[model samples]
Target: MTRAARPGAAATRPGFVWALPAAVFFLMFALTPLLLVVVLSFTSWDGIGEPRFNGLDNWTALLHDPVMIQSVWTTLLLTALGVVTQTPVSILLGVWAAGHQRNRAVLSAVYFVPLLLSATAVSVVWRAVLDPNFGVPAQLTWLFGDGNLLGSKGGAIGVLTFVGVWQFTPLHALIYQGGARAIPQVLYQAAAVDGAGRVRQFLHVTLPQLRNTIITSVILMVVGGLTTFDTVLILTQGGPGTDTTVTAYYMYQKAFKGFDFGVGSAIALVLVVVATLISLAVVRLSGYDRMRGTAEGL
Candidate 1:
């Protein structure tokens, strides 16, 4: 009797026609621009004229520009803050909500309200709410003295961080909530039999079970921080100074305001490289590609 073909081979068989539309879309929109940017980064183009080959001039300028350096630092700081503050808080919120069945729906809705609004809307609303003359700042004058958060370097940074955390935390919490729900109830019972208190059970069973979810959250946080633009643009517009001007903002200024497409492309390319490297490092450190069980091993 003839052996039937394996499912794996059948599944892996080329389906070029089925994939054609997606392949075409990727090539036209994604791959084309990426290739264009790499080519443009080596040319001196002012967005209007023909691009003239400029070698390493743009790269050298990017390396030495003080404002560029500051923006890069700010971007890194923002990403770091998101990773530090958002991911764990999201998990904690998820755990709290999961344990409290009655309030879960209400709590989830409240947390997710910010996400329902467009980024532009959130920025506008927050701008008004944080206005020094008439908003929360006015009420908190005793704490902040001048209460002009968007008008100061450190305050602007803090405001951006707050906005980032507020907007994304709910989404991350949802991710964690799903992961938490998937965990076998038996694990908690086993831990309880071993005298594991709530905290101990969380540290041992819940967290370990959510290892993949946590790593995924971290990646989203980092990437979100890197690409954060509309909030800063609408709220602060890169600041009273350059303090809130992230690498993305700086790249925009170079490309649009400065009309230097070459340098702007270089900055974009640099950010792409940095983000990719950082993501890979996070995955490697978390051992995300290794064995699937046990957070300790990861």
Candidate 2:
């Protein structure tokens, strides 16, 4: 009997034609709206009439607006805090969860439950829990003061950051878990032979091996942090006098609440530019765009 023939690479490889539909969809939905928003930024619109040409007006207003400036700083502050808090936690949890132990597998399933909930649901649940009159804070007045987490600037910001860490860490943890598993076991054995203990092995071998994964996770965190809206809306409504107002929420307030679509579009464009530039810079600096590092061998 003749041996079965293997499929050729030419046959297995997908061509660009197969991706045309997705490309078209992205162009229609993503690029088209973005282009419209860019144009809208240079025009005055209130969602009632046609956009009127008003070059530099929106930009000038946004640049001089104190609230806009505060929102940018607030955005950066939240994003930075998220990165600092979530990255280490995700890495540690991911490494631990990557183990083949059955107990760990069970715990990992439980740990990732938060990621399954919608942001809206999570916010609603937490909002109730933090309610000053009816929630846990009410019962524990001695500890939580008035339990009005959404009332003050510091309290609202704290709740937002905490919710972010709780809800998003699982996702980054899963990313790191996959990266940890992809690391070659031989490297660990070699470290062991060289008298490296668990801590040293993890630091010298595991961390270096997970550089690309770390970068990927960090980029995702930065983007998510920048675009945070639903949580803020449901939790604080940008209240406490704009203390918790992020750029994304500010854009919504301008476009929808205040009926200033021009400034809102400008804010939206700025957000897109900021996120793109930061992500691109990170990719360039980390050499990740070239697909370098631990992925080479496997």
Candidate 3:
């Protein structure tokens, strides 16, 4: 007769069997490409040719590259503007919609419509809206007479930021709405009993409760803004003199247009590092681990 398996054997078996496949898949698909990119960053390669090892030459060149530097700055600016502009609006709309349960479905659907459209579609629509000569701006100019909104730096950045905010606020609003729903109504009732007004209740109860969701939404928006390419490419193509070329777009131009694969890889690697660091920093700052701990405690 066979001996009975030990108590911990079953638990170990599943993990051991699963671990090998998961590790193999990760190494083959994920880690291997990352390693190749890291290796390529140190080599000079045109798209069709073999790469020649050049040590840190690509990175060194990137450091002195004006366009790359501007792209990085623009990306950071866009991310900052996106978060600042979108977060409060999303939270306010979410809280309002959640509070007004009667109109929650209609309002949520209205806000989420933009997110359903592809970036290309949104960019095309907005391009016409912002066009100075024959679009909505022109119509407005006819009423108000001759102002080129898309031509000016401030106006251009404002339009980009506005588009980013409009497209993403709905996503965050939905996330926040879910978070708001999860909040126990008894807390609101208690706050009301203590003579707290709507704004006070939101500050004291809703904001703190929805902190984790807000953190997550902000992280998503920031990353999207940082790496944004399609909408900017369609709308501005880093136009008005490189005002809107984000790091991702810059890398695309470097790899494709300039045909500097090695330098492009280095820039892409820097973007990955930046995104990873920002995500980690946000999670830590927002006390994401604390939420995990609470869930574990429960």
Candidate 4:
């Protein structure tokens, strides 16, 4: 005999049949290319003749390369910075925008314009704005010193990190905004009845409700930060020395510029492995993978 379904519970969770198409597509596209890259990583090829198997040469080279190590650290540092800077701001803006206030509609429209611009466009605009000749630093020399924001290591990294935060924060904000809107209003009303103030409501009611959303947003941010490419290519070009030579750009240089496809493939494979491991760790530690119910209604 069938048991009666409980009210407010998910009536019909998506089954494996619903996911078959995407699974097939992923296997055909993503997994196929990944396997090809794995094979290429084990071979020496310059994009000319047939690739010759080189075994552990490509792997061992990157293991001992000082620049490679530094690039890994830089990638991790930028990713960490992005999470730290973007999370709170995104949450605040998102929660605010989730309100019924009229100003929110107007402000959100203007605030979301940055996401319309491509990474290349963002980089170019920022580069012009920071130009030593006539950019903000030039006009405000006393404030900006020499106006060479991309000339030095710290300045270059700062610009890159800021640009990343600026361009990507809106997207994360949208995610949080949606998550906030999805929360049951009864919870907030009950909290209000309990004499919970605005700050208390947010801290206790909103944040806990958005836990899964936060996990999702953070996973996206980590992946985006790890694989940031176009901005680095267009803005800094991994220049002013290798100060900004992140792993992605370094792979580009090795593969395209240096004409060492083998090494580049090896680096790319390693990046994929590292990103996967870190994402799994986040899911595991957050207990997102072990839970069964949704984040709301608590």
Q: Pick the candidate with the highest lDDT.
A: 2
Report the number of the highest-TM-score candidate: 1
Clashes of each: 0, 0, 0, 0
Candidate 3 RMSD to the real structure: 4.4
lDDT per residue (tens digit) for residues 224-282 in model 3? 98788887788788877877778998889888998988988998899999999998899
TM-score of each: 0.92, 0.91, 0.90, 0.91
| Alpha-carbon RMSD to native, per candidate | 3.3, 4.1, 4.4, 3.9
User: Which candidate, 2 or 4, would have the higher lDDT against the true structure?
Assistant: 2
Q: Score candidate 2 by TM-score against the native.
A: 0.91
Ranking by lDDT: 2, 4, 1, 3
Give the number of colliding residue pairs in candidate 2. Answer: 0
Off by over 4 Å in 2: 1-17, 139-143, 295-298
Q: How close is candidate 3 to the true structure, as a TM-score?
A: 0.90
lDDT of 4 at 176: 91
| Residues 1-298 of candidate 4: C-alpha lDDT, one tens digit per residue | 4979778467576779999999999999999999999999999999999999999999999999998999999899889988999999999999999987899978987999999999899999998998998888888989889888889988988999899889998999999999999988988999999999999999999998899999999999999999988988988998778888999999999999998999999999979998999999999999989764554236
Cα lDDT tens digits for candidate 1, 187-279: 899899999999999999999899898998898888888888888889888987888999998889889999999999999999999899889
Tens-digit lDDT track of model 2 for 86-178 = 999999999999999999999999999999999999999999888889998999989889787788888898899999999999999999999
Among all windows of 10 consecutive residues in model 4, the one with the lowest summed lDDT is 289-298
